[model samples]
Target: MAEQLRLVVPLHGEQVSNMQQLVSVMLVDDEIMALNNLKNLIDWEEAGYTIVASETNPRNALESFHKYRPQIVLVDIMMPVMNGLELSREIFALNIPVRILILTSYKDFLYAKEAVEIGISNYLVKHEINEESLILELGKLKYEIQNTETNDRYLRQRLIRHLIGGLLPPENLEIGIKNKYLDFKIGSLAFLFAKIDTSYPILKEISVVAKSHSNFIWDIFNLANDTEYMDAIRLNPDEAVFVIYFKEEELKETVREIASKTCKKMQERFQQDYEHTISIVPIIVDNKNQNIRNIYSIAENSFNYSVYMGKNIIIDYESIPTAVNSSFKEVSVILNELESDFVKRDSESLKNRLNIIFTLLGKPPWNPEDVQNTCDRLVFTLVKFRNKNSIQDNPSKIEISNLFNLNSIRKWFESEFISSVENAVTIDALRYSRIVRKILVILHHEYNVDLSIEEIADRIHLSAVYIRKRFKNEIGITILGYLTKIRMEKAIELLSTGEYKVFEVAELVGYSSSQYFSKVFKKYSGLRPLDYTSGV
Candidate 1:
């Protein structure tokens, strides 16, 4: 009979909490029956732990340990091929922080001592042990796992906050690196900023195809230590930034393959199950001799390029143009354009000109800092405009420089621009006011002639799509329909005066033929033109 049997003893009819706060355990022994008996050795849930894996073969036990990363292991010392000591050493070599206890015979005291030397947490005498002692040791192991995980999480939380707040010096960041608590050294960390808009349910489906959001995040955190490091933390509902630490020389070979492959696999899975977009922008901080604060600043400026880059992509910061601020004559021109476009509610022109100007600033030979400063300079103009203009959309002064990605920057600008224009622009100049009023004015004066919605859009320096959306949103009807209603009302007024013939009245109210005009008038007015002319 084979000694190695891979299994997890099923606890039938037992329901576990979805967010169970339980430490997981694995057991290994030569006897299958002994493995089964060990399952009942501790009240797993009560001790805040559960038996996740049980295998008779030491080889199978090692495999399961790596796969599940169980927090605790209980193994028998006397086994063929790989004894308990060899197995414990192999487990500890992974450096994943698991507690391993050996089950040995009293006659095997020498072997037990050797096992202890190999870093086994403790050894249990097979003949002497009872549930009480087993439970006591298990409780201690559970405490150790709890304390370690808690401390690691606390350290990580503090580090992340400090980095985000830009509060820590490079020396402070090096503390975690020196202690091997973080996956990478302080000087070699890179940031991968991503914008993900997904529901938990959708993520669950995607998770089945690819790594879960949590696992992918943690993988990068420990990429400096090993490729297999897995962890995840959600920053908020929309955005998350993952860190990958790497040496500058490793960027071409080892790091690029790992980073690109991870991103591509996740992106392919998302494309398979979901239709929405995802954004990933990777920026190497070049921290070997740079300050931590400078890394954060530069990385942020570089990531802003991703706004132009679509979702489900892996973008390298080095490949994109770094923005530099120059006091070129073009800066003032762009600002002047933004001031007029924002007030005129001319989104199409505004966006086009912005894309051109932003590209100009982002071209080669530009420092990323100066480019961001240029953008900051432009935003300041918008802020000044907002203060004087009607509240078309006063998106509060978000430190645009503080925004990390291109998509974020463009989204913020588009959403808050027309509405947040300066008070001095006055309400009448805004899109809401201008688009609606302009359309009405055009139709009122031109109702007696041929006028198309496209023509109205052209006259206002806006697209038909923009006009239609704003028209329907504000006036509650399609442009053509509104034009028809105005034409009909004018026709009725002309007929009531009883001065012009029906054909003449039709031409006067924008009808090419009096016949089509009469047909439309009767349908809308519930009577022929003559009946209406009779004043009935």
Candidate 2:
């Protein structure tokens, strides 16, 4: 029965309830019958505890104890070849918190005194150990362990905050190290700052999953290969910071390699699971004289460069250029030329000029503020041209200012700003020809129908090849691509009303398979149709 029970027990760290985790127990006795009796003494799982290991030899018990690291150990006091007290001494020397209950036959006061002096939690006289008595004792130990864990977690979080904020004093650091709250050694320290890319369209919705992402990323870095110790703290809803301690100074390159691998894993997991991306900046502080604040500041500064470097990559601090460029006059010249292109209604020239400006801005030595100011100036120039030309449609100031990165800014310039300008331009018969207008009408009105490019071309008495080329040239996207975009937009509207199920939305969006529709929806919007409806 003891062997069978051990086989069926839940492993340590398994969840017992939403708010409670199973406490693990290890049984150590020199007698096989006594060990089996202890295992069968009570229903351990019912009491929220699991018997991970049971041993008849004290030496094997010590080995199993280290391997399982159970919170509670029940050992017989009168064991041969390394008695229970000697084993307890060895366990205590490891400095890990564990409750030891001595099972003894002795009734002497001296025996109990020795057990207490050796940090034994409680002793159960072997003959008097009933199921009720054992359960009561285990209850007290579980409560104490839970309290200690809660306090330890709180202290660890507080200390990490202090370290990151540069407020931890030398004395506090000493005390934290001594008390085992901070897991730092005489080793080289570095930091990895991670943040979800803010330029994602549904950032507000993404914030709902930020805490879970933070925990997942923390686990990734904490379990990083070759890392001696790691601790992480969430700096905000969108960002987290991790401090990694390496035991050897020569592992600097090892740190970068591990960080790179970790970041790649993070990218793969996030993209595959969440359909999202994140930016990680790894900073290795070479100067031991600097404090934690200086190290964090360096990582933070490196993280800011993600705007130029783009998303889903590791930005190494040492790789950044040290030189600064302040060529606002050259940027002004490009802005003036962009305004000329806009006035000429040359959409192609406008695209080329915007690309030049963004490419120049992406080069090193420009700060975010410099980019922002340049972007603001460009918005002003376009808005001025629109106002002078009496064009009603223009990108709002808020939309222009809210762009967070170079990629997002460039996308906005093309899609929102330039597209609006193109639409407002006086339609030349040679440009926005009658054939494209008819196709646009068909797409907007009959989007839910199974209309293919060939069928539409046949309906309009044109060849499919000619229409496909004409559509792409005029609309900047293929007919099918535009159709998908329209369908997805309509689906969003339908889902926002909270009146349609996913399948219904799928059908209304011209998709035959709801499963395929969901996949496409997630890829298009970074959320499932259900998540959008549920406001997640």
Q: Give Cα-based local distance difference scores for all models.
A: 0.61, 0.71
| lDDT (C-alpha) at residue 355 in model 1 | 73
TM-score for candidate 2 = 0.56
Q: CA shift at 437, candidate 1, in angstroms?
A: 25
lDDT digits (tens) for residues 1-536 of candidate 1:
01111111112123434224577789899998787777876666776777888999999889888777688899998899998888888999876678888887666667767877878898888877778888888888878876766666546655654656566534655574435633344234445565553321211222322224444433333332222122223454444565554432344454555556555554554455444445666555553544544555554565455444534667666777544545445654565556445545566777776776666654565554444555565566565556544345443455333344444455456555644533433554554576677886676556667887788889999998999998899878988888788778667756765667899888767888888999999988899998899878
Question: What ranges in model 2 sit over 4 Å off?
Answer: 1-20, 169-179, 183-196, 200-234, 240-291, 308-333, 343-345, 360-374, 383-405, 415-536
* Number of backbone-clashing residue pairs for each candidate, in the order shown: 25, 0
Worst 10 residues of 2 by lDDT: 2-11
Cα lDDT tens digits for candidate 2, 173-226:
447543563434334555678777655232223233443555555444333321
Looking at model 1, which ten-residue stretch has the lowest summed lDDT?
A: 1-10
